[model samples]
Target chain A: MSFADVNIQFLEAAKYTLGLFFLTLLIAIPLGVVICACAMSRFRPVKWLANTFIWIIRGTPLMLQVIVVMYGPGLIFDVPMKNRFLAALIAFAINYAAYFAEIYRGGIMAMPKGQYEAGKVLGMSKASVNGLVIFPQVVKKITPAMGNEVITLVKDTSIANIIALPEIILTAKNIVATYAIIWPLFYTGVFYLLMSGVLTLFFKWLEKRTNYYKA
Target chain B: MAFYQVNNVYKNFGDVKVLKGINLELDEGQVLAIIGSSGSGKTTLLRCLNFLEIPDKADIYLKGENIFSIDNTDSAAASNADESNISEVENGKNIQTDSEKNQPTHAKKAKPEKISKEMRKLIDSKRGHFGMVFQSFNLFPHFNVLKNVTLAAKLKYDAHAPKGFARWSKEAKAARKQAMQEINEKAVALLERVGLGEKLNSYPCELSGGQQQRVAIARALILQPDILCFDEPTSALDPELTREVLKVIRDLKKDGHTMIVVTHEMQFAKKVADKVIFMADGIVEEEGTPQQVFEHPVSEKTKAFLAESEKSIDEE
Candidate 1:
């Protein structure tokens, strides 16, 4: 393949990688927040359910989770999986949300109880206390941990190739197979590196932005 | 005829009796200071008044309105001691005739409704009526000093504003702007009053212990509460800082604000308090005017505690 052809092809595949990454984050972060809230819920049954879900997701490997999520319905229920993109998206979102929920729980748990008490004594409603005082501090605390997970997510997108979902690495492998060119396969590393580098920069900016809250 | 009364208050924390049948009456513009050794239930009593620590049974009455009774407006219905209500006082001291004395405590009436759950919530929303300053200050560390002082006031205003007024009406928006201007101006003045005007932009962590406590005091005062409760507000401060905080509190006393202060500062207590309550274990051991309590304490427990406290001061 010509250099320009390689660029155009890689860019087209980059779209899928970025789409999976963004969609997973868009779905997972809010899902993670809800899960974290449930995990810390006052209701014992809800808390237990959330904890059990987190334990199951965390104990198993993400690769295995992705495989099972993509194929488990087809294998167990005898229902053929319809959409490859939807399968990949569901697998990634579920796996990442579990990890993100734990990070959120840690952030929420680390805050001083005095913050809530102070908010209450000032006549703030329970919801207002969480939104105005507690969540901002939690967000500041979880940023570094979240940044690490996000960087890992960039690389984990490559695992989608196991199910023939053509993201960046799969496209590279296709090029190597068709044209018998070894260079494009190595060029794929550059794409992952650049994506992670940009994400690292973005996360660094986020951490700085939240520097106003000191513990 | 008292402005406020904590009648037959009791609290237990998992079998440990923290407050046992505590009773006291407070007058308007009176500053009552509570003093005791550690674990003496002074803080618990303050918390009970604010409903921060829900007492097992407390009949808190403000201007003869049973604040913990369900229907405070009906004097006939106020016989159900445990029911609660929110009484918003607006410049009138329409002293209801004291009917509580005539109602026999043992008179068998239909069982009072178990309204503690609903009353707990009702009392909680009325907590703004009692501003509290903790020993540790407990200022929101995430907020700057100005935000810390203004936060509760703004939220309270927002909460009490007619529902959806801010979102739907131009008139409401104009009113809100005017209200916000007044809040900010009042907040600035409060910060200034606490000697923290120059530190308005400083974060809680950036301020010293005394400065943070002053900010906390300002935060509490912004609500313009009916009563200000201090849980050893200067306990965490050094002597210099303690003096600064005490000076501010003294100024508040001069301003005729009703206050309930729990303090180890006996001199400050004696100087500022209209009534001094000396508590030991879980009950009031002795209480009187500051002169009688400090100079002629009736109980051995009060006398001993005062002597020990004075010895500690001498050692310092």
Candidate 2:
């Protein structure tokens, strides 16, 4: 195959990889906050249920979780597996949301009690206290941790290949088989590197912006 | 009626009784300084007044309005208070209750009432009556000095704005913009009063401890509270910084602001306080004019505390 053909194939596959990454993040970030709230809920049953879900998702490997999400339903329930990409997206989002929830909880719990008291004494309502005073500080704290997960997610998108989602790695491997060349496989590293490098810079800028406030 | 009155307030943390049947009354334009060693519940008392820590039983009146009252019918808590009192006496800590002597009997028989949502909302609304300055100067770190001072005021204004008009209406938007301008002006004036006129854009992290505390003071003052309570306002500052914050506080006193200051600065207490209270082991050991408390303390506990404080000052 010509370099142009390989480049075209890799670029098309990169679209899938980028879509999965962005969509998973778009869903997971907000879902993580919801899960974190449930985990931290004053209601005992809700807290336990959220914590158990987080525990199972986090304790297992992502590849296994994805496989289970993709195949387990059809195998056990005898339901036909429909959208492979959607299944992978669901698995990735659920897995990452669990991790993000813990990071969020850690950030929030690490906050000084004085922050809440400061808001209370200011006559702010409870919702306003958390929304204005607490969450902004929590975001600053969770940024570095969230950034780490995001970079990991960039590479983890390749795991969708197991479900034959035809992402970048799968396309590169197909080229390796057809053209009997290996560099296309190695060339895929450039895409991951560029994406992660940009993310690293973005996170660094975010950290710097939030550096205006110190805990 | 007193401008602010804390009647028969009691607070407990599990088995530990923090404030036991404390009663304090302050009139308008008066500064009451509460002096005590650590764990004497002075800070807890201030927290109770600010509603940061809800009292188990308290009748808090602001401008003769009963802003917060909880009747703890939990007989268990009353007995727990008594037990803690015995433990305090056994520890050889004086259990003086000159003001609280009659409160226990009254509190034990009261019916237990939970802090209902309505009551909490009421207390939250009434919280504007008291402004609190914490020892740590808990200014919102994410906000600049001016933003920190103006934030609560703006929130209050937005909450109370007329709801008849749509938020997007020109009249409503104009009113909001004008209100914001006024809040900013008031904040700038208060910051300037606290000697932070030039640091209005600076974040809390960029300022020194003294400057942060002053910002906290400005933040509190902008709310126009009926009373300002300082919980060891200068305890976290260096001596020089302490003097700077105390100077602002002294200036506020001269401006006729009523304040309750829980502090360890004996000299400042003596000089600035209209009334001095000495608390020990969750009770007021002595309360009087500065001359009476500092110069002629009646209780042995107060005398020992003052002497120790003076010796520490001398050594420093």
Candidate 3:
């Protein structure tokens, strides 16, 4: 193969990695907050339901959840599932939402209860407590957890290839299988390491910004 | 109606009885002080006001209406079962949301419309009408002073309590606007009152303990609440810093605002207290004018308390 073809292949793989990283984030942050509300809701059933979902998600492999979400409707109900990209998105959204929910819950619960009562006597309601009193505090509390999840998500998205959704690792593996070369596989690590490193730096910056909450 | 009254309140956690037949009362324009040693249920008594934890048995009144009704042991379990069963039986009859489980309990007791609605109406009235401060300043760590002060205006004062009520109407817009204005003007004024006018934009950590407590005071007072409860607001401060906070409380008293303060400052209590209550073992052991309680203690507990607190301050 020409050197130019190998360069193009690397570019193609970079596009896939970048796409998955952005897509997961675009879906995860808000969805994680929603999951957090469900998990830590004042309402009992909602909390129980959210806890059950997290328990199931954490207990099982992400690989299995990916397959089930991607293929379950078609396999179980004898109906065609949506496009592979959409299935992958749903699987990723749901799986990460559960993980994010736990991060949020942990962050929120870690805060002193006095903060909440303080919010209350401040005449803030539960929702206001969440938005004004709690959410920002939780954000500070969860930055590390969120940072970890986001980094892990960068690597986990490669599971898209199980159903042939064509992410970075898939791009690398396919090229290596055909060309009798392992450079693409090793090149895949560059994308992950770079993304993870950037996220780590971003989180450190966020932590520095949130240091006012140290009290 | 006195703004609030807690009559014959009882609270027990497992085998431990925290508050036994406690009585507390606050009127529209009075400063009632609850002073005691630690673990005396002073905090628990404060918690009961908002139903954060209900009394095991009691009659609580707000605005002359009965707001708290304790359960008889026989009916407590029965009522709990009936509510759960009613929902379980009705679960198949209609759509259900995940949050239905924590819906206000009054809905299950009387007519779905009458009693529960009245109960909610009563609870909603309490919102914004009263405010509390803690021993620890408990300021929102993430937000600046202005946003923290503005929270009641944007969220709770304008928002209804005992939520899940139907939406307010177009006619209610004026009330909403009025509430908004009250929250804004009053919060800003309160910040000024607490000497935090310039620091409105500052975050909690940027301030000293005295400054943070001042901000917390503004955050509490913004709603124009009928009563402001300060739970040992100065305990966390040094003696010099405590003087700054006491000045603010003194100003509030000068303005004729009612208060229920749990304080360790005997001098402040003696000076500003219209009535001083000595709480011990979750109940009032002694209560009278500050002079009567402080200078002439009636109970052994009160005598011991005055002796200990007075000695420590002088030693320093």
Candidate closest to the true structure, highest DockQ: 2
lDDT of each: 0.83, 0.86, 0.74
DockQ of each: 0.34, 0.48, 0.45
Instruction: Give the candidates in order of lDDT, highest first.
Output: 2, 1, 3
Docking class of 1: acceptable
Model 1 agreement with the true structure over B229-282: per-residue lDDT tens digits: 999999898999999999999999889899999999999999999999999998
In angstroms, the error of model 1 at B302 is 2.5
Provide fnat values for all models in the order shown. 0.68, 0.75, 0.60
After superposition, candidate 2 runs with Cα above 4 Å error: B76-114, B312-316
Residue-by-residue lDDT tens digits, candidate 2, A81-154: 79888999999999999999999999988888788888888888777888999899999999999999999999
- Clash pairs, candidate 3, are none
Model 3's alpha-carbon lDDT is: 0.74
| C-alpha lDDT (0 to 100) for residue A30 of candidate 2 | 93
Candidates in order: C-alpha RMSD to true structure:
7.8, 7.4, 6.9
Candidate 2, residue B263: CA error in Å? 0.4
Give me the overall lDDT of model 2.
0.86
